[model samples]
Target: MIKTKRLLLRRVRKEDWKAIQRIWKDETVSPYAQYDNIKELDDLSVTNRIARWGREAEYYNHIFFAVCLQDEIIGYISCNRCVDAYEIGYCFHSKYHGQGYAKESVLGVIAYLLIKIQMEKIFILMVEYLNYSLDGRGKCMKIEHVAMYVNDMEKARDFFVKYLDGKSNDGYHNVKTDFRSYFISFDDGARLEIMNKPDMADDEKALNRTGLIHIAFSVGSKERVDELTHSLSADGFEVVSGPRTTGDGYYESCIIAIEGNQIEITI
Candidate 1:
């Protein structure tokens, strides 16, 4: 069993078949049906159903979990193993609709996979993907194989090109996202993620988190660090600290942005 502060991921049992079937049967659900009205799992014996899944789960390639919220099962989240990663799939019961429970549950799922399953990479592959571009720019970010949200498709497209197109400096990227904005990624695998919060608003709220944190970028040498900082500052991205060595042997500086996100340069 993989348990988080608010949820648990455990094996599906005979008792869960009905709830699982019921959730799948809902017409309101996307990806529509597990089986058509004619072949609906109405007649499948519970033992047979369990036997079907039990053998498969034992294979270690697929782990089917009944997502339990507050000790009560309401949905299912599963990971299907691929060549070098796991694809996560989840479905929630409409009965628990609008609770933000899905997000929390998925968070738990990631932690579970990272900690227990030790999955190197996990991707969300939605059947009918959705994305939220609250930025009003109508742009959507083609993120790590996740659902597409309801937003202006054009703006979302432009958003990816302008900000989220996976470019980064020294393995880091900071960009505006929907609502609060987002941090983009680079090809080498270092990633950044943030909400739709703009630099101004995020900066203000970030200081409230009470601890100091900043994005650190490494340059080739102290002189190059100085040159880059001077050029970037001239270009209007606030340059904070730098050319100074930390007690631990790295040279660095912090630049405060209107959003309070830091641009740290180091050598």
Candidate 2:
């Protein structure tokens, strides 16, 4: 059982359904929560699915948690085991509007994962259609940029610096090259490099899929891997599969999310 000053998080018990239904029924909650407006609010189907889903998660170490205010249930948070990391999801009740509850709740869960469970990496699967014009930006989760391949070096260089890199017409690379390149980096040290070279094509294959495929988290080692797996389960992160070793000599796992992205855990 996890408790905030005004909220409690635990596995959904039989009695939680009533509060769950009530929370979902709030008119102010449905838009952001993505409920159907025309339908009479009934989460019997959802609760039923979640209950079974939680059970199935045990085999893979996946877990689910419900947020309650004293006895009134408000929302839920979920984390799933993926190839060496935790993937997160959250939602809340409509009645608790205008409070920083959602942000608080998410941060709380993440802190629990990083500090308590000792998870090194976390992935949040964001799909385009599933996006909410959130804050008017791309809402791509603090992404610096998504760079694709380009051809024709000299011409592309001028175009890139002129438009993307915020550069002027006069620019020169440290070394002259006929190949084109793109760089995407996070505020943190995370970075991705793409260059138009024959050998580089294979390297890009790891990340550049035409469609949304998978998001992964990197962990320290196999021991840390199992520790995180068990720790996340204790905190209610669902594990879909593994602590299994992949062909590359790394241990990995997976979990599913609402917007249809796979959370891959690997070391």
Candidate 3:
């Protein structure tokens, strides 16, 4: 249970389903539902959903909480761990809107996650597909994908595919813009978006360039780092840095690709 100055956040109970249903049925709150249009749900449908939420204690290994004030349920909060961060969402009864209850309830839940649950970082994707900006959320940044221009899309694709074990998408092409690209996805949901134009020149990136310096891939172990360094070097890839501990205590090695792009393989 999470308690604030004016709110109590707790697990939803069978009895709270009625209030939850009312909150979901509100047009104001229903707009925030990502998976379904809860405004159209009848009492039976709401009851079943609430029952499912109650039965699924972990909520698919995440969490859902009820926000209460003065012993009356007023809102709900749910979170899911996506990739390297957590996505959080909250909704309240129309009557409770603009009372700071939503923010307070969200803060309480965040505290529970960071302090009690010991999460390293928390990120908020949203409750709905529509975008709504938050004030001073401090978690506005989450890298969706890293994009780069590659001189040789095929070689760049092959490098990531062979070394990082990346899975290639079907790739994209735009004849009008003369743009071609490929998306390489890693196991941990990180993606590299490499694009190219036919007339683009192959230039060596200098160390002092004022842009993205390098991209890093985590291999999970020092042994794997050494092995990959040797194997990549043998395959004629440029080995820039060491398979030794760095100043920041990372067991890593840096390699230069055929496109002259730097990549750091780390543990």
Candidate 4:
């Protein structure tokens, strides 16, 4: 059990399913939840589902905590194992919204995971419609740049500038470390930093490798996607995938560009 000033977070019990069901039934909470058949689930089904969650906790370390206030279960926070980190998700009763209980409980749980469990990383999972700002001052946050290590920084910078219409700044160089980089900016305010350093390991980028696989840019239309894709292919860059509509409806093409990195041009 993890306790904060006004909240208690403990491993969920099967008996707590009624409170969890009540929270899930809330109009405000149900829409964002993954379980679509909460309304159709009978008491037996809900209990079985809760038992499965408990089993997952015991077997896989994927834990679901019942967030309680004054001895009442008000909501739940789930922490699922993802690679080396934990991905967390939460929901609460609508009446308890905006009370800071969720925030307090999340902090307590995070502290417990990091300090007591010796966890290295924790990720918060949110719904697609929700905008989570990392800025503590209540200001809007945006990605300033995405950076990557490259062998030939100039070749990488030229690839972006020539094909993708990226504008490059006068590159930076560190005398002590022999490090160099260039910041290539796009018209839509996105920036990419291509960097180089001595003795940097160049691992073979397997097609199914994890981590960042590609950087995608929207070119405004399907026609533009086709046009640019043909242009890149004509210029000898390998077109790894088509300028075709994907299963998820993305009209895009993937190309092996800039030191074996994949770049996706989309509409």
CA lDDT scores, all candidates in order: 0.56, 0.55, 0.75, 0.79
Candidate 2: worst 10 consecutive residues by lDDT? 163-172
Per-residue alpha-carbon lDDT of candidate 2 for residues 213-266, written as tens digits (9 for 90 to 100): 654655434554676667655645567778898765557776442122344656
| Every model's TM-score | 0.42, 0.43, 0.49, 0.50
Q: Cα lDDT for residue 120, model 4? A: 97
Alpha-carbon runs more than 4 Å astray in model 2 = 24-29, 35-44, 54-60, 125-245, 248-267
- Best candidate, TM-score: 4
TM-score-sorted candidate list, best first? 4, 3, 2, 1
User: Which tens-of-lDDT digit does each residue in 60-163 have in candidate 1?
Assistant: 45667888877677888777666467788777877776787678778887887788778889899544323342235644433342222212333433433343
lDDT of 3 at 34: 39
The candidate that wins on lDDT is 4
**Lowest lDDT 10-residue stretch of candidate 1:** 145-154
lDDT, candidate 3, 1-267, per-residue tens: 889999888887666788987776674444444332224356764565576567545442347789988878888987765444567877787788778998888889888888876777777645444334322653334576899887778988988998887879899999899899999876535788989987777676895699889999876455678999999999898898898877766668999875778889886
- Residue 192, model 1: Cα distance from true site in angstroms: 46
Q: After superposition, how far is residue 110 of candidate 3 from its true place, in Å?
A: 22
Tell me model 4's lDDT, rounded to 2 decimals: 0.79
For every candidate in turn, the CA RMSD to the true structure comes to 18.1, 16.1, 11.0, 17.9
Q: Give the CA lDDT, 0 to 100, for residue 241 in model 1.
A: 58
When 2 and 3 are scored with lDDT, the better candidate is 3
**Clashes (N, CA, C under 3 Å) per candidate:** 31, 13, 0, 0
Q: Which scores better on TM-score, 3 or 4?
A: 4
**Model 1, which residues run further than 4 Å from truth?**
27-39, 45-47, 127-267
Q: Rank the candidates by lDDT, best first.
A: 4, 3, 1, 2
